[model samples]
Target: MKILVVGGYGVGKTTLVGAISEIEPLTTEADVTEASTDQDRTAGTEAKATTTVALDFGRITLLRHGLQLLLFGAPGQPRFWFMWDDLATGALGAVVMADTRRLADCFPIVEYCERLRLPFVVAVNEFDGSFPYLAEEVRDALALTERVPIRTCDAREPASVQAVLITLAEHALALHRAQRPLTH
Candidate 1:
């Protein structure tokens, strides 16, 4: 199985992938330099020193179910969006991570998935000191349709990340079933 962990800049895409990956996650993070300060948006992630320039790759093997998930984290910066289509190729679905502080940042990714007809679940990455918002409220705020699942989690926790992935998998399966033609 292939999945893309996508979100806006500094929304914890790499952290989420690393938290649950069974192997050493492959990350292409580059130091944020002053040269591109004007190009990169660093509003919500002021403390972030590095950015994923290409992608983050990781794998999780579910031995019992005989499933191995290849997780890919897309680069969040707008300038790197050229890499998104290539990364999204052959992906089964996506987890759209969002931070309430900068909710608008998630619009592009949501639209990207929708335009591609890709199934996705929205995961609100709960950051400390951030205001508490219900899943329903977030759904409404994002103007998401009823079919898209919305859930909250601390992306840094392995268990929490696993739950998000589980939700995503279930949602994807449901979508697949719904789209499948009924046979005799």
Candidate 2:
């Protein structure tokens, strides 16, 4: 199943895709502005020069059932929202990464996934060691469900990134099962 990694500009969508992608990812990199850097990167990612303009694509093989996942990173801009629906088709689920600096950036993506009734989990990418706020507070602010897993990820580690995919798969399987019609 394909999974869409979506978030706002500089929100680590590309990094997330790159981290989990078993194959080298295909990404659209473009120059970023100083204004947007604060919202996207703080310290660890300060060296950032280019940002994804379109999407990032790659694949990963799951340990369970040898299931394979195609990861797609959404462009962080609203204009690219047009491609979001298409990218999401047939997706098992999504990991919508968020930044504490700009929590609002994640709202649209989260709402879109919900509207589509797609299973999704939120990951707060730590640009630096410090979190401006607590995870519970952020979850409250987003009004996310208790069952929707929220966790932290570095976006540079393959093992850590794979955990996100595994989590989504669990949620997706549950979602589909719940939607199955009851037998008479």
Candidate 3:
């Protein structure tokens, strides 16, 4: 299975990928070239040091199902929107991360997943000890329908990151089952 992990700058998309990756991960990160600073201004994720010049890729195996999963992390910068199409191609699903403080940065990703008809889950990456935001409130804020699964997690936690992957996997399975004829 192939998955695309996407979110706003400094939202811990890379960290999430690293936390759950079983094998050596491949990431395309470049020094924060001063010229591109203008494109990296998102309030909640200002701590991001290296900008993903291309994309982040990783692979893992789920022991439970013996499923090999490939993950592609898309660069968050709007200027890199061109890369989104390619990263999304052939992905089984995607996890769109969002920072409560700068939620708008995630809309483009959500829209892209919608356009591609890819099953996706929205994960809220918490910062510090901040209180949890209501999932329904987030749903209303993002104007998302009830069909989209919304989850809250700390991108820094391996378990949390894995949970997001599990959610997407389950969603993908359901979608696949729904597409086929009943095999009674």
Candidate RMSDs in order: 0.9, 3.1, 1.6
User: Which ten-residue region of model 2 has the weakest summed lDDT?
Assistant: 36-45
TM-score for each model: 0.97, 0.86, 0.92
| Global lDDT of each candidate | 0.92, 0.81, 0.85
Each model's backbone clash number:
0, 0, 0
Residues 1-184 of candidate 2 have per-residue lDDT tens digits of 8888987777788888887787888987878777656555334446668877678999888677797889989887775689888898988888998888788878888899999988999888877755666778878989998878887777888877888777888888888888899898
Per-residue accuracy of model 1 over 1-44 as CA lDDT, tens digit each: 99999999999999999999999999999998886567877876
Query: Per-residue lDDT for 115-153 in model 3, tens only?
Result: 898999999988885567899988988889998899998
Q: Stretches of candidate 3 above 4 Å error?
A: 129-131
Best by lDDT: 1
| lDDT of the structure predicted as candidate 1 | 0.92
**How does model 2 fare in lDDT?**
0.81
Q: Give the least accurate 10-residue stretch of model 1, judged by summed lDDT.
A: 35-44
Model 3 residue pairs with clashes: none
Which pairs in model 2 have colliding backbones? none
